[model samples]
Target: MTETQRPLLEVQGLCKQFPGVRALHQVNFDVIPGEVLALVGENGAGKSTLMKILAGVQPPDEGQILIDGQPVSLANVNQAMDQGIALIHQELNLAGNLSVAANIYLGREPKRFGLIDSRAIRSASAQHLQAVGLQVSPDTLVGDLSIGRQQMVEIAKALSIDTRILIMDEPTSSLSQGEVERLFDVVRSLRDRGVSIIYISHRLAEIEELADRVAVLRDGENAGLLEKDQITHDAMVSRMVGRDVSRFYQRTSTPPTIDSDATPILKVTDLVVPDHPQHKVSFEIHAGEIVGMAGLVGAGRTELLRCLFGVTPPVDGDIQIDGTYTPIHHPIDAIKAGLGLVPEDRKEQGLVIDFAVEPNVSLASLKAHAWLGIWIDRQREQVEAAEGIKDLRIKTPSADQIVRYLSGGNQQKVVLSKWLVMNPKLLLLDEPTRGIDIGAKEEIYRLMESLAESGMAILFVSSEMEEVISLSDRVLVMHEGHLTGQVSGGDINEASIMNLATGIQAVS
Candidate 1:
């Protein structure tokens, strides 16, 4: 790409304001043909808001968007698509009940006449899927596919459009390492075909790998733009956060205490579920310890967490809390027993989007705000919610701001705050850092450490091998619902963990 080449999309003086705060402050950005422009920002930095404006999910309160050097108005999603702009959001927009082909060709299905053309749609969808390296049958229902496959279907849908500029928001957040590589390949092919890509992601490595130019946004404004040669992880971090974060991952080691040898806080024995009956699972997590669960997708990692959290009942198992065995038949049982689960899917299960930030943060411990046997104490709730927001560095105009308006990272913080209010003896975190920016991820890591130091037992589950290895005191590798192996001390690493996860017997 040369400096003389015209940009496919140009945004100037973009601004968006809500009731109390300005979300975007005269933001300016542009994307050129056949180039990948990485948009880097912390949560609440207005990246999503800007993208929504470009995609016509919302119109900008101020500024102009030029397509091919001509001012244009994107009134709605349909108009945006007609103008060759497509956006794949972090939360998938696909209907799980529909087939892959149907989802890809959803509203714009090809028709021979004025009637439906299922055959043509299926054939076109198959071609698009192949272009994106997705091998799933076009007729397969999207709900049955894994998160990674569903993401591929989304990319395939975008590819099927005559997209001049595509916005991908955290596309690889849940994808496995192999799947990420495949996605990168697809992106490269799209770039080669002269499609401009506006890539928004938290994964710095992915940005470095796929972006031709990196643009940093801070406090709703364009901080700076660095060419590929000048872009380093530290540089991008400093730009996005306005401070040097050299020790982001460095945690002060707290020595194991006398209570470490005491009774286990959470004990799962012979836990079995209908979806995964291959293994009789057993694990014990003590207070003041962070136990990590590592595995590939479909290895039953999530199922194990779900069962323990009472989202799915264990067919046969004994759960012991504080030396007393108990049966958990529902989530309420787990909650009453001092167990807090921060679910993997924030939008679907963890958050009530329509609710305000304060309400969402105080959800798990709302009973604490009861003034009497009948009345709810709004003052106490607001106080606790304010503390949570301040403690977690959650950016919002006010505690009364709707959670749906916050960015992905801020939303995750609200979820964490909801659980933290309970002050549980045990915490179950499944992909806690999913879709959050690097700065927010660092904050979450520090928060985890602080919680552990406070004698809270955390069972952390993540697909990222590095996160698992860096944060876990003991790594439990799972394979097809079975405990494949356990890595402690020096035994935990990418290669060693991968060996156990892939059934290559290195533990023996």
Candidate 2:
């Protein structure tokens, strides 16, 4: 794309090493003016390391960065900004307590007569906000806005610096479908205006839809590159992992028959979630079966899971685990009733990032391993940690290693390990593979299949249609807090799920 146009940014022989790990080795890539270049790789493929080096957050051990054919030293973040490069990290860096205009020009506020220029801030902030197509008042508090709107504000703030090169890291990981479409429109507008965009995401579908050129990295080295026309799903997957991942969903056993007379492991009747008390939902998930819950964003899928797990108690319902009625008034009650929940935002709900893996693994089952149900048992905790790590193939230096330092996928495994301690009859996974890379996704998919085969009933909520289709034996569709329909066998296709999700087809 615009190959004749001189490269706006070029990375040459970039090398970085961190103690025992060689993060990048002679890595090279370039971006032309006004194009979306997708940088993709698995979780530990040196993507974050390279991005940090480019943004000047960390200095490269050896390398050269060039802008318009001239080498430049991005020795510090301020220098990177001066050279027109800005990075929007996955975890947003906005001061939520401040106003929109205040956040846009947080430290670099315009001044009038040596005083903070409130009027100038509002007037100029409006233009940048419009550039990102974010329709919000400059006086609006950042905390009051939704996650999608806040993301737009971050882009607007970057534009305030007149950024010519923008790097977005997993920008849509937390966004809804409508929000994703809006963000794509903004990216297109930025590219059309001669601003080079470096888009990084694990979602290959997004790369296929948006990228003009895709650069794949593997194990800290350049794997391959694909031009616009060559960016198919198989091509991207092969390049990233150096293999053709045709069978992404690893299901060895046959799918369970949904209509079988076998006893259901978990059943809910007249289940009324606190968020949507008007609707009463009913569903059943059998032992050794994986049930997928499909619905549009904000359709109360998460709410229902929360209700089932007792994060938010239901207004009224009967939840039976293995044919026993369990009225869960709290999360502990749910756990006692043989239930475990892996919430969507793992960092917040699942694991304590600052804590070690061993502690998190035994957190839920502490009493079970405790002596006289009083003091904790350290030896038992270690055994549990070892088994979990070995069983899940978790990659970590030691059980004492802080979980925050682990890759997204490994961190997720730690979360799952925490729940495996309980040996729940039913596991509720909300957006199970939300932000992890593809390679990790395969591991998790295999784990789901394995767990189901081992007789654990799984009820997972997912926004990815491919994931639902691949893993689910039975599909339950929801619309506006209502259980609208169920599909099994060949009926578990995208059209049926979407129709049921949108309430176009409801069960009689």
Lowest summed-lDDT stretch of 10 residues in model 1? 247-256
Candidate 2 error regions (>4 Å): 1-4, 18-20, 247-250, 257-263
Look at candidate 1 and tell me the lDDT of residue 96. Answer: 97
How much lDDT does candidate 1 score? 0.87
- Report the C-alpha lDDT of model 1 over 188-279, residue by residue, as the tens digit: 99999898999998888788888999989998899999998987888899899998987336557653554555899988888887678766
Which RMSD values do the candidates have, in order?
2.2, 2.5
Clash counts for the predictions, in order: 0, 0
Question: Which residue ranges in model 1 land beyond 4 Å of their true spot?
Answer: 1-4, 255-261, 367-374, 505-508
lDDT of candidate 2 over 384-432, digit per residue (tens): 9999999998888789888876778888999899999889999999999
Cα TM-score of candidate 1: 0.94
Q: Native-vs-model 2 lDDT?
A: 0.90
**Candidate 2 least-lDDT 10 residues:** 250-259
The numbered model that scores best in TM-score is: 1
